[model samples]
Target: MPNRQAGISFCDGPKEREGREGRPAVNLRTLKYFVAIADAGSLTAAAEAIAIAQPALSRQMHALEEEMGVPLLQRTARGVRLTQAGVTLYEAAQRMLDEAQRVKRQLAGPSEAGESRVVLGVSPTLSRVLVPGLFERCHRTMDQMRLTVREAFTPELLDMLEKGMVDMAIITSMGASADRPLALHPLVGEPFALATPRSMKMDPIISLAALSRIPLLMTTLHRTVVERQLRPMGVHLNIHSEIDSVDAIRELVHDGDWCTLMPVSVFKEARSDAGITLTEVSGVQLNRQLMMATRIEAVPSTAVAALREIVLAELARLNRLRVFNFGKKPVKR
Candidate 1:
């Protein structure tokens, strides 16, 4: 009051200077408004789209520009055009909005009447045997639930889970190490068996040494698993064809001349003439751990929990049936 301007210099206080120099604070709602303005190309259109008064929208835009310490838009008689800084922010805002929408959808849970939607990813090999039965079981048990099954490889399925695209996955563990951010529940440890045409002359039990002599049609993706198990035993596989498709490999093996190594579950399918026969491989037990994978941060919904239980129960039942030739040993829950 004695001398108002005597002590208060323009940049005397740190807080006052900080307000002028610091970066602007932006939130999702502000970003949304900016995006609307950018898309509409004018305050009038943006205000109309957002159902806000033009004056209020203009005031908000002025405040944003002042806080940012930059001119974001160039006013025009017809409409508005974004400055360079505004263009950069617009692109970033668009991406943020897209991710926000995805997260919202994921968190929205189900719809009315306790009806839920669950997405399950399964390997192509497993999907052949599991999808139809799983679908039927899901529909029968949870009449209000909708289940979507996606068939993909282990790596692809893992990616889908991490991105929140799939709710759960049945995948084969590549090694002892488990992926972080994913919860792995071991469903079964399945041993590899020699699958040959029923007409092929082979022993009911084959040695790793004897397996090297057979012409094998195997998936190229499983070569690493095969080598890891066979190299220690000094047995080298003579792979005839490296096929990626499970159906193609099965068909090629069913030709009676080519044999393939697969999980015992693959041979359980009923066949008339060109049937497959599975023989236990002695000498070295090459086991693949089948795991139920879900995101570590995700808590399963009621429908998802029911689906998981159904899958585990079915796997246990299949194990008890000795479909994987585990000798009456049920899979550990």
Candidate 2:
């Protein structure tokens, strides 16, 4: 049977319980110390890192090995290395510690100051379009919340979410990945468009085939998403420059005859500009789905829920104003 504590359940499976009847019980603090030692690669280093005495750290590790009835670490002249059993326990302890921290946060709920802290991640492409409205709404309505925004591309954002660095992320959804057990909520579907200099005599629409011949500058992130969809059907982009910065790409496109392929929402501010012409690309349903992702194991705090609601509402408002042409139906991933 699993032991329930503070609304969290922990169970010792058959494999875990198969060992001895007489052993010291390992707790979270000990597991944390073990992890630190493993990460530090030396007991002295671990002790310094965790602010514990060297003797105490050594005793803890010895007791831990005895509890598991296996030598967790092989002490060498220089430092220490994990035994096979230690590797297994290290992996399990990491997961257990992560779960414990998450539960502790959940139990704590809002801060003592009555402010909800939420770390949000947004892709650079969407940050400009979303942040202003989000901040305004939060100030006007959600006054009791402290919001921290991290702006990065899709890949970096996903990595941040997995590491628990960000509470939630709005990113270009590449569907589910087996390695990342995240809960994704589809937010919007945005179509791709081409931004060309006004001097170039072109129609409002261009085919994917014609686009292949035209010289274009593209950001690395957008290129990855667009090419993943277009490449299979014998389509390739004429990417003359692979720049990761959107602003730099836009500046280059404006100064030269170069064009860039990006999500339509990315060029919302430049749509009516006299120097730039935003055109829709045809011959392919080239678009990216935006989704909100959180760790699957997370229990949404009041602040997290509030932040989500505010984001959805902000996107809805932008859609209504035709700021960006959002699809009528958001495709669920």
Candidate 3:
């Protein structure tokens, strides 16, 4: 079982549990030293890089190998070469060090007198519409807060949230049950729409059957969502192109007669463009839940809390304006 309070999953691997048999425990500092040496190819160089004595670096490596009961390195005239075991240990050590740094960043608090910094992850589908307003709001109201925005796909954002690389993320539902490590706060159910060239003669609300007859460009990531919702109703996607970038999809639909199916959020900024028009899907109410996800183990800083408030307020404002054709009003929780 994971340590819920600390958010650390205990490993039961034999190498991880080697200390159970009265062996000296291997520490992260030691792993860091070993990785440094492995990367530098010489203890003398590694020690200088890490600001440690060369002999001390050697001693730590010796102790680490002893703890694991394996010979990890072989001395060479030019430098040191990793043995088979050394290669394995080095890979694992590198991952551990990276994860450690990520955790440290996640747990770091604002300085005593400086501006608080917060990292927010936004899914690619919503970044274009959400980021500019979010950044402007933070700059106008929260002078003491600094924000870093990372735009990625929903799966990538979820992974970053899990690894403590991001403080909070806005992601679309993938139809999976909620994960224990994450606290999901529902924002809205954004409805899907048909994006067509402005010149195309289309109904005010296009049905799945009507969309199927048109050549379509759909996002590969969101295809699953459409499949899940429409496949059961015997509607199949007639995808002409599988593009990942929303901007690319929009450009394609704008330049050609091809139409694409996507969330109305994608067309929010481009609604005024004479090249494209958006119509809600009619036969099926295809939508995905948009939610804010934060690590369950995280203790939010003042900046993070403030940013959350700003985001929720902005989302509510957008909801009131019917900006993205959210299927229903967001319920206050």
lDDT of 3 by residue, 74-157 (tens): 999988989998999897776577667666655785567777877899988888778888899999999898788888888878
lDDT of each: 0.75, 0.79, 0.77
Model 2, range 281-325, lDDT digits (tens) per residue?
Answer: 887888888889888865777888999999999999888766567
TM-scores, in order shown?
Answer: 0.64, 0.64, 0.66
Q: After aligning candidate 1 to the native by TM-score, how far in Å is the CA of 222 from where it should be?
A: 1.9
Q: lDDT order of candidates, best first?
A: 2, 3, 1
Tens-digit lDDT track of model 1 for 1-333: 121211211221212223323443455666778889999999999999999889977876875676655778899998899999789868867666755655776688667677887889898778766777788878888898788887777887887788777889999986324645888898888888788878876678988778888888888667779878788768899988888888888777776677888876766665612476678888887778899998876566776788899898778767676766635334457
Best-matching candidate per TM-score:
3
lDDT of 2: 0.79
Q: Name the runs in model 2 displaced over 4 angstroms.
A: 1-111, 175-178, 270-272, 326-333
**What ordering of candidates by TM-score runs from best to worst?**
3, 1, 2
Off by over 4 Å in 1: 1-109, 175-177, 272-274, 326-333
